[model samples]
Target: MTSLDDLPIRDDLRGLTPYGAPQLDVPVRLNVNENAYRVPEAVALDIVQQLARALPDANRYPDREFDALRAAFAGYLGHGLQSAQIWAGNGSNEVLQHVLQAFGGPGRSLLSFTPTYSMYPLLAQGVGMRWVPVPRADDFTLTPQAVREAIAEHDPDVVFLCSPNNPTGTAIDLETIEAAAEAARGIVLVDEAYAEFAHDRSRTALTLLERHPRLLVSRTMSKAFAFAGIRVGYLAADPAVIDALRLVRLPYHLSALTQAAAVAALRHSDAMLSRVDELRTQRDRIVDELTALGYRPYPSDANFVLVGGIDDPRATFEALLERGILVRDVGLPHTLRITAGTAAETTALLSAMAALRAE
Candidate 1:
C-alpha cells in the first residue's frame, strides 16, 4: 500500500487531517450540529416531484447562472436582497472557497478569530493563502476593540468572522463586525451558517451590507431547513462581489438536481423550518439541565451547546458512546460540544450525564 508520506502530497497539507466528526451508528447522535428533525413528508414529496421534473433535462447542463435559484434565495433571505446580490455553490464550504479564490491568494492572508469554523484555515491554505488565527476572549467571545487590534496587526487580505460561532456557539456583536469592516483594508466575510438558530435572527451581517460594500454574508439550507443531504449554500453581497465570484467559478458548478431540490425546499420554507423553534427549546433545555448537573455550558446562540468542566472529555465521550449516545470532543480543553437533538434525544443525553456523575 502506498502511504501518504510516500506519495507526492503538498508539504503544507502533509500532517493535516480532513475535516469531519464521528459518524457512528449510535441510537442518539448529537454530534456535527445537524438539525435533528427529519424533513416533513409534504415538503419531501414536493422536492421529489421537482427532482422528477428536472431529470428529463439532465442531458443538458443546468442553468449556469442558477438565476431562478438565486431569486428564490434572495426571497428567502429578505433583507431587501435581490437576485443580483446572491451567489451559491454545492455547499457553504464551496462558496467560501470561491471567495478565497477571487480575493485571497499567495502573498495575501486570511484572518479570523480562533476556534471558528474549523474549515476556514484549511480553505485558506488550499488556495495558497496564509491563515492567521487570533484567539478570542477567554469566554470565547470577540469584542470590537479586539477585532480592531487583530485586523490592524495582521493586515490580511480577507477577514472571516463566524457568527453564532462553531464549537463555543458564541455570536459576535454587530459592533465587532462594524469594527472589522472599518479597520480592514480588504474583504470582510461573515460566515452565518448558524444565523437561523440565533436568538435574534434579525441581528445579521446582511443588515450591514448596504454600509459595507466589501462585506459578504454566507448561509446554508442544511440546518434550519433540514436539507443537509442536498448540499446548498449561498452568499449575499453587493452585486459587484457576485460578479467577481463568477470569474472564478466553474461553468454550471451547481447541478440541475441540486438547484431543483433547493428551490423546491425553499418554496415550502415555512414547513421546512417549522421545527426550528422546537430545536431552540431543546438547546435551551440542554444548557439549563447541564448547569443543574454542575457542568459548565457556554452561552450559545447556535443550535448546539459547548459544555466544560469535564474531568476528561475523551473519557466522557467514550462513556456516552457506550450508553448509545454520541457527542463531539471539539479539541477544547475539558469540553464537549453537542447538537440540539429531539426532545427524547436530549433526555437521553442528560440522563446519561447524570448517571456518569452519580457513578
Candidate 2:
C-alpha cells in the first residue's frame, strides 16, 4: 500500500491540515456560519428558471468575462464602482487565491493579523508565499498605530484585513484600514464577507477605494444572500487589479449555470435579503443571551457571536450537539461561535445554553 509520505508532495503542505468545520447531523446547526434560512421560495424558483435556461446551452462555454454577473456585483457594492473594478470566482476562497496568484508569489509575502480567517495562511502557503501573522490586541481589535507598525516591520507583498473578523466577530474601523494601507508598500485586501450583516454600510472598506487604489475589498453571496450553494464571491478593486486576476484565472472558469443562477439571485436581491433584518435581530439576541448566561460576548456586526467564558468549548459544543444543537468550536481556547440563525434556531440555542449552564 502506498502512503502520502511515499509521494513527492509540497513540503509546505506535508503536515498541514485542511480547513473545515464539523458537519454533524445535529438539529440546530450554527456551525459553518451559514445563512440558516432557505432562499425564499419565489427566489428559489427564479434561480431554477435561470438555471433551466442555461442548461439548454450547456454545450457552449460560459461567457469568459461573466459580464452581467460582474455588473450585478458592482451594483451591489455601490461605492460608485464600475463593473471594470470588480472580479469574482467560485467562492471568496478562490477569489483570494486569484489575488495571491497575481500579486503573491514565491519570494513575496502575505500578512494578516492573527485569529483571522483560517484559510489565509494556507492560501499563502499554497502559492509559496510567506505568511506573516501579526497578533491583534487582547480584545481582538487592531489600533491604527499597531497596524502601521506591523506593516513597517513585515513589509509583505500582500496584506489581509478582515472586518467583523471570523470567530471573534470584531469589526475594523476605516481609520485603521487606512493606516494599514498607508504603511504598506503592497496590496491590502479587506475581506468583508460578513459586511451585509453589519449595522450600516458606512463601516465598509468599499468607501476607501478611490483614495487608496492598492486597497481591495472582497464580498460573498454565501452569507446574506443565502446563496452558499451557488459558490459566488466577488471583489472590488482598481481595474488594473482586476486585470491582474484575469491573467491567472482558468479559461471560462465560471460555468453557465453559475452565472445564470447568480444573475437570478441578484435580480431579486432586495426581496431575497428581506430576512436580514430579522436575522440581525436574532444575532443581537444571542449576544444578550450569552452575556446573561455569564459569558462574555464580543461586539459583533456580523451574523454570529464569538462567546467567551466557557469552561471548555469543546465539551460545551458536544453537550449542545447531544441536546440537538450544534455550534462552532472555532479553535480558540474557552470560546465558541454560534451563527445567528432563524428566530426558532436562536430560541433553541438559548434554551440549550440555559439548560446546560444549570447542570
Candidate 3:
C-alpha cells in the first residue's frame, strides 16, 4: 500500500495534521460553531431559482470578476464600501489563503495571538511564511498595548485579529485594531466571521478602513447567514489591496452557480439573518446555565461558550459523545468549547451536564 511517506512532499508539512472538527453522526451536534438553524425555505427556494438561471451558462466560464456578487456584498456590508474594494473566494479559508499568497512569502512572517483560529498557522506554513504566535491576556482579551508590543517585536508581514475570537469568544476592541495598524508595517487583517453574533455589531474593523489603507476586514456567510453549504466568503479593503489579491487568485475562481446563489442570499439578507437574535439568546442561556453548574463560562460575544473548571475535559467530552451529543475539546486544559444550538438541543446538553455533575 502507498502512504504519504512514499510520496515526495514538503518537509515542513511532515508532522502537521489537517485542520478539522469531528463530524460524527450524533443526535445533538454543538461543535464547529456553525449556525444551528437550517436555511429558511423561502430563501432556499429563491437560491434554487438563481441556480437554475445560472445553469444555462455552465458551458461558458463564469464571470471572472464576479462583479454583481461584489456589488451585493458591498451593499450588505454598508460601511460606505464600494464594489472595487471587495474580494471573495469559495470560503473564508480561501479568501485568507489569497491574502497570504499575495502578501506573505518565504522570508515574510504571519503573526497572530495564540489560541485563535486554528487555521492561521497552517495557512502560514502552506505559504512558506513564518508563523509567530503571541499570547493573549489572562482573560483571553487582547489589548492595544499587547498589539503594539507584539508587532514591534515580531515585525511580521501580516497580522491577523480574530474578532469575537473562536474557541474562546472574546472580541477585540476597535482601539486594539487601530493600535495594530499603527504599529505594524504590514497588512492588518481582521477576521470577523462571527461579527454578526456580537453584542455591538457597530464596533467593527470596517470603520477603520477609511483611515488605514492597509487594514482589511473579512466575513463569511456560513455563520450568520446560514449559508455554509454554499461556500461564500468576502473581504473589504483598499482598492489597491484587491488588485494585489487578484494577482494570485485563480481564473473564474467562483463558479456561476456560487455567484448566483450568494447574490440571491444577499438579496434576502433580512430574512436570512432573522434568527440571529434567537441564537444570541441561546448562547446567553448556555453561559448562565453553565455558571450555575459551577463551571467557569467565559464572557462571550460570539454564539458559543468556552467552559473551564472541568476536572477532566476529555472524559466529559467522551461522555457527551456517548450520549449522542458532540462538542469540541479545543485542547484547552480543563475546558471544552460548545456551540449554541436550538433550544431543545440546549436542554439536552444542560441535562447531560447536570447528570454528569451529580455523578
Candidate 4:
C-alpha cells in the first residue's frame, strides 16, 4: 500500500513548482504580453468558415505529417521546402521540449542568458539536462566575449537565445548570435517568439542552417499572429534537424482546428501586421512615459517594457491591480514588466499609474 508520493520520481523535478503566467481578471490586462487586440471580425469569420467546412473530418485524427500546414507556414516565411525546414507542435514550448529530447540529455547541458525567458531553464530541467546561465551585461546585451567564454566553459548541447527577450525586452545583435553559433559545439536554438514586434529584421538563422547545421530558429503564431489560444508553433532548421524532431514528436501533435486557424491567420497576415504596428506605437509611448516618470525602462524591441530599480515593484504591481490594471511582477525584487495594450488600454494604464503616483 505505497502512497503515490512514496514512489521515487525523477530527482530533477522533485521540488519543482509549475511555471505559469499570472492569472488576474483586471480591466486593463497586460501581464502576459499578449497582443492587446482580438482577431479582426473578417479574419474570425474566415476561420469559422474554414472550420465549418472541415468539421466532418474533425472526428478523424489530424494529418500526422501536418504537410499542408507546414507548407503554408514555409510559404509564409518565403522559404522553399528544402531550405524551408519546419516542424509543428502544440506550442513553441513543445517544439523546444522536442529540441531538448533530441539533443540534450542527462549528461549534456543547456545554455542561455540570465533574466531571459524563464522557460529555458525549466525545459532543461524537465528533460534532465543540466541548465547553465551566463549573466548578461548590465545593459542586457550579450557580449560576444561572454558568449564565447560560456560556450568554451560549459560546452552546452543546446543553447536557447530569446531575441527581444521576454521579461527584459532586450534583443541580441546578429553578431552576438553569430559568435554564439560559431562557438557552440552542439545545437543553437534561437527563440524568436517576439520577433515581429522588434524594429530589427528577424536575424535569418535559417540562412545559417546549412553552414551551421546545429542552428534552430523557433517561432510561434501566438504573439504576432494573435493565435495563442490556437497554439501553433513551428521550428525551422536543417532538414536533418527537422526530420529528427518529427521522429521524436507525438503523432498528430497539432489539431485540425489549430491547423485551420493558423492557416487562416496567415492568410490575414497583412491585417495582423497593421495591428502589430499599432501595438509598437503604443509600446514606444509607454516607454517614453515611463522614462519621463524617472523610472528607467530597459530599451525594448518587443511588445513589453521592463522597468527596473522601482521603489517596490510588487507593491506597484499590486497598486496597479487594485486600480484595475494588470501588469507582471517578474519577481526581480524591484522590477516590473508591462505589456503594451491597445491605444485605449495604454491610456488607461498610464492614467492609473499617474493617479497612483499622486497618492
In candidate 4, list every pair of residues with a backbone clash.
Answer: none
- Clash counts per candidate, in order, are 0, 0, 0, 0
Summing lDDT over every window of 10 consecutive residues in candidate 1, give the lowest-scoring window.
269-278
Model 2 misplaced regions, further than 4 Å = none
Q: What does candidate 1's lDDT look like per residue over 1-359, in tens digits? A: 99988989988989888888889998999998889999998989998999999999899999999999999999999989999999999889999999999999999999999888899988999999999999998899999999999998989999999998998999999999999999999999999999988899889999999999999999998999997888899999999999999999999999999999999989988775669888999999999999999999999999999999898999999999999999999899999999999999999999999999888
For candidate 2, what is the TM-score?
A: 0.98
Q: Which stretches of candidate 1 lie over 4 Å from their true place?
A: none
TM-score of each: 0.99, 0.98, 0.99, 0.95
| Tens digits of per-residue lDDT for model 2, 228-292 | 88899999999999999999999999999999999888888798567877888999999998899
For candidate 3, write residues 1-359 as lDDT tens digits: 98887778889888667778889999999998889999889989999999999998799999999999999999999989999999999999999999999999899999999789999999999899999999888789998999999999989999999998987999999999999999999999999999999999899999999999999999999999987888989999999999999999999999999999999989888876678888899999999998999999999999899999899999999999999899999998899999999999999999999999889
Which scores greater on lDDT, model 1 or model 2? 1
RMSD of each: 0.8, 1.0, 0.8, 1.9
The C-alpha local distance difference test score for the whole of candidate 2 amounts to: 0.91
Give candidate 3's TM-score.
0.99
In the range 1-359, model 4's lDDT, one tens digit per residue, is 98546779876666667899878777899999888999999999999998987788988998888777888878877645443387888889999999999998789999999888888888888878898988888888887888999899888888899988988998888787888899998999988888889886555555566667788888889889888888888888888898788768887888888888888788888899899999999999989997787777888989999887578887898888888998998877578899999999999988877776667
Ranking by TM-score: 3, 1, 2, 4
For candidate 2, give the lDDT of residue 182. 89
Report how far residue 354 has shifted in candidate 1, in Å: 0.8
